[model samples]
Target: MLAVLAGCTGGSRDIGEGKPGSSGDAIQIFPRDGAEDVGPERRIEVSIPDGRLERVRVTRVEDARRQAVPGRISDDGLSWRPAGGAGRLALASKYSVEAVAVDAEGRRSARNTAFTTVVPDHRFIGYFKPENRSTVGTGMIVAFEFSRPIRDRAAVQKAIRVTADPAVEVVGHWFGRDRLDFRPAAYWKPGTEVTVEVGLRDVEGAPGVFGSQRRTVGFTVGRSQVSLVDAAGHTMQVRRDGELISTVPISAGAPKTPTYNGKMVVSEMHEVTRMDGRTVGFGGEYDIKDVPHAIRLTESGTFLHGNYWAPADTFGSLNTSHGCIGLRDVKGGGGSAPGGWFFDRTLIGDVVEVVNSPDRKVAPDNGLSGWNLSWQAWKAGSALR
Candidate 1:
């Protein structure tokens, strides 16, 4: 019977037999003992040809963290496999399976086995935005920037799920091969809770390059706040929940380098940050070490920041910036400065629409500006379509 149990390891040399006086052949574990380089697509299971399975326990250890792999035994006690999302084996991990079975004669038998999942030559991961458990503006879009270019866009997209509580339709749009952003048809209604599930583990993102991340992150949508910037008028209107809250003077991009015209989301905010012209492809035109209350509006370096060096009159009357929106502020920021006030009130996902600028509308893929695209156009970028 011990030899029979050893055979149940599928010819594996390393097999653990049942206790003395029990039928070792009564229990079986798949992937066998000593299995190595097992692919995730291969299912891990335990079974008995006859009698009944009493209990089954599976565990996976990766990166020094031990996690339970949930599973259930069949009603007939003939088989057991992982349940639901836990069925997918994590990459580069060690899995252990233990099972107990009772034979027709009422003799209890135990079996223990383990296997190591495949460690790919290359792995891919995604760095997502809006942070877990964070409260963000309604315009926040769940975006993922992958570490490596993805070849199987469909597989990668399918692995991710973005759902909301107040349940509006949300869809994902791929920006090239390395970025994927998800959003609803319109800005999320205030107070919506959003959850993102990234099940990229073991998913083939490229040839022989498997995804190594499996995580769930969530964020809540705060109140509605969208500011509209009129470059021609040199002013910005701040609105909260469709109510005009304030109208502030501003200086837009100069004619030679006009700001992008269209809806732009505030992707980042800084109380004070260095601005180097050379970093954004400008020829050393301006390098302010401490640009106060800087808000990033585009990936290509367009900011709505405080301009202390420019004449106080420059705001509200001049479009003097190379391509940034400027508001009046002092050297160290703070006080009731318009720049600081806006920065204080702004959330990461808030919208900042620009109008009347000669420059073309900001591309939908630039920053989190997908709101600029029509619903139909946005859906067209989805890989599932």
Candidate 2:
């Protein structure tokens, strides 16, 4: 009956205005199938002849699941680019593409979807410190917060290096899960330059986490002034380049709360800083609320600063104070007062030893101070080649 309608037997007529073999067919995906070593963030483009790409979608690894990831179809309608999500393949197990295109008459057309393989065997981490391209005094540390914890800390520690002028060598030590610090065998030489380099790329950290840290941090070492305070002896000795420069009557912590021991590096010298007893477990059930002009000596709430409330007669004679080292000084870190003169001559990296304080040296990881760490231990935390 159809042949009779066509007026010819066994003859056929094609439908619509589209030529034979016109679009609405499967679009081709480049890179082919079963391809290996594809980057985790590869893009699959589409080719269309008589239509414009309306939408592009992707499927999960199993091919049974589908999702619409973000990407843009080129304005010319010739190519498409995949704008993967944050962390790229890190957020997805696998993905494939399914594109849709529309012709002139609002006719919809879609192509056969192609699956792309996702291999996420790569890892990355950061080596970031708080100091950003600035000169930090002895109070700052050559530190790095790793993005991932290392599988073998000893292996990674080998990649962290520190070099200083005047032939001062330092080491990198592990701090907690993801922090490492570098410090010299002694305090950095005053007026010297220090540089730290960490190469942690492709380094295997903990399970499934990789290290991607590659950076060089540099800072200048200021001055060397190592002072010794013996509360029992009722004397404080200040030395510059091994020369006995000055002596002041300095009081230290009483028996109840002593200062910390070890290589104590001067971190901050504020003319005044508010100290709260509640913050550091002082003032019993209540907080002192304010300890003014407190110079942070250690990370653990220790300060060698002016004590206006203490007896002036005990300035150089007695060890009678709270947990702080008390020195007589004006309101600022300068002027004729013994404390101010001492502060003016002191620079970063200068050492101040409170021999009788019962507290401990601040932990290397507690803050910017790194003097508590030994060079050998510091060198044992790198995760690089």
- Going through the candidates in order, what is the number of backbone clashes in each? 0, 20
Decoy 2 TM-score against native: 0.56
Shift in Å, residue 41, candidate 1: 33
Model 1, which residues run further than 4 Å from truth? 1-121
**Which digits, one per residue and each the tens of the lDDT, describe model 1 over residues 126-220?**
76677678788989988887767899999999999999999999999999999999999999999999988889999999998999878777889
Put down candidate 2 lDDT per residue, 307-356, tens digits, no spaces: 44445676666655444576765432345777677766765446776565
TM-scores, all candidates, are 0.69, 0.56
| Candidate 2 residue 240 C-alpha distance from true site, Å | 1.2
Residue 302's C-alpha lDDT in candidate 1? 71
Worst 10 residues of 1 by lDDT: 1-10
**Which 10 consecutive positions of candidate 2 have the poorest summed lDDT?**
2-11
* Model 2 / residue 66 / CA error / Å: 46
